[model samples]
Target: MKNFPLLIILISLCIACKNAKVIIDDPINFNDQRKNLTLAYLKNRYGIEKDDPTIDPRMIVLHWTVIPTYKKSFEAFDNPTLPDWRPDIKNISGLNVSSQFMVDQNGTIYRLLPETIMARHVIGLNHCAIGIENVGGTKNLPLTKAQLKSNIWLVRYLKEKYEINYLIGHYEYTLFENHPLWLEKDDGYRTKKTDPGTDFMKRVRKAVKDLNFKALPKN
Candidate 1:
């Protein structure tokens, strides 16, 4: 009869672990300055005059850090201000580019910021999109299978938690330019992207096909 209680405890633990994915909390700098910059970006770029830097998260944009290593990738986003190397974007705003979650090459998921907080990851859709960045997308350091698995899990997890309706690769953001979700004010302010590759997105989408996320908008 004593063994019966032990079995119940083990079963409960397994169920709890399965429901809670193992995501490490590795936060990036979202201080006062960063918060101000985000609000400014929302007002200037998207015309959203909000009191707080938060979003409803209607979309999830997947990306891969071309930076090669997890450490370098995290460092690139850890700062509150934009790095000088990204002159193309730094001129537009001082808000450093960041994502809500970053997946390591080995499939470890790290949450960088709160899911509802606005991150300066995707253009035009930052106000409603949650970003997921996978480490290592350079020619020499392509995303691994482990990353694909993690991304699938994350997409499913977020969809379950929020009202996520669309899944897209970074390169596909332009298609939403004229869609109601598109919010960038500057017609000239657009950047080309090819992060987290088409193949990676395809695999992840296929894995979560049952979820029936809305299709990408036509360009």
Candidate 2:
């Protein structure tokens, strides 16, 4: 049958497309100033005096950028220093908030920083957590199903590549404050968070149930 070879080719292409990941290398500004700020944050906040601004990545923390579009989201993290509007956090450190990966509403995953590098996304666990931010989490522009799928895929990919033992929503970071993983020195320096809401995290965690990430410490 002449059509047999054509069918096989079609099937192979379908499989490849199905398994293909849509990750883009859209990095933010991580110049010398950012590196120095990160090192300072590590030392002052976590008491880690490392020469490099890298982390072991024992956890993956998920977040949602309240900013609507991918472009705006990118701009928010493009700078190395915290913006003026965030004076509350600027008092602590000048390092801008950033994440390792950001998932667009259409499910396009963008790598903003190196996975092993410390990002100022989460509060206490930035020293050992890789942050994944999803664009659009406002009441009007909630996260989409495409983002959910992309997050699941990213979680699996990171888990396979790193020694990640925990997966948590940004809101869940406070629960680890007393856990051994937390390292922030200033006990009063905590911020409230509800990004990447409970529903989104529940769905993602359900999908990756087989990964068996350690349970979040009881609040």
Candidate 3:
């Protein structure tokens, strides 16, 4: 797959989404500026030294922010600085740390940072992991059909573009604890996460079946 051209598509998609308002009923798109921002985020947040030919993305880790809406989620990640809890990237860059994408309850997929760049969504495998955050994982507000659909589309997009092999939920990331870390630079470190849910990942896996990727049964 042509990763670079797909990136161009993603950038155009991000550009198209700039004027978009979060409407649960509508299919939201993305824009170039947003795409570039995500790419820039990867560079600043992870301090990726250079692309590693061997660093094949093995999994797509699903997450949830427990936040309310898309606007709120966007504002949260768009902050040029990450919070103190993000000690993982404290030494790398002052840029606020986080995942590659955020899936809103309304099913809007917001790109935070690019997939190629390491995101802090999960620890132990930040370098080879791609994090997808879904908004609204709270008591009253659960993930919606719209969010699920958007997540599926985004997952398929990534798998095809990056030749992604595994898919798992944030709750299941610990399963990769023994897997070798691949930062392509850093020695790697442990990270913590417990967002999103199993049922959610099952649904995502089902959605990406055509890609020939399957979710690892939870241990």
Cα error, candidate 2, residue 109 (Å): 0.5
Candidates in descending TM-score order? 2, 1, 3
Query: Candidate 3, residues 1-219: lDDT per residue as tens digits?
Result: 669999999999998786343423221222444334435545543554443312347788888888787777666666556667767666655545457777766666666654565554664555677888888888789888887877877776777688677777887766754454433234454455556776777787777777886545433
For each candidate in turn, the TM-score is 0.91, 0.94, 0.64
Off-target runs (Cα >4 Å) in candidate 2 are 1-13
lDDT of prediction 3: 0.64
Worst 10 residues of 2 by lDDT: 15-24
Clashing pairs in 2: none
Supply the global lDDT for candidate 1. 0.92
**CA lDDT, every model vs. true structure:** 0.92, 0.94, 0.64
For model 1, residues 60-153, the per-residue Cα lDDT tens digits are 9999988777899999999999888999998899999999999999999999999999999999999999999999898899999988888998
The worst-scoring run of ten residues by lDDT in candidate 1 lies at 15-24
Which candidate model has the greater TM-score, 1 or 3? 1
Q: Largest lDDT belongs to which candidate?
A: 2
Clashes of each: 0, 0, 12
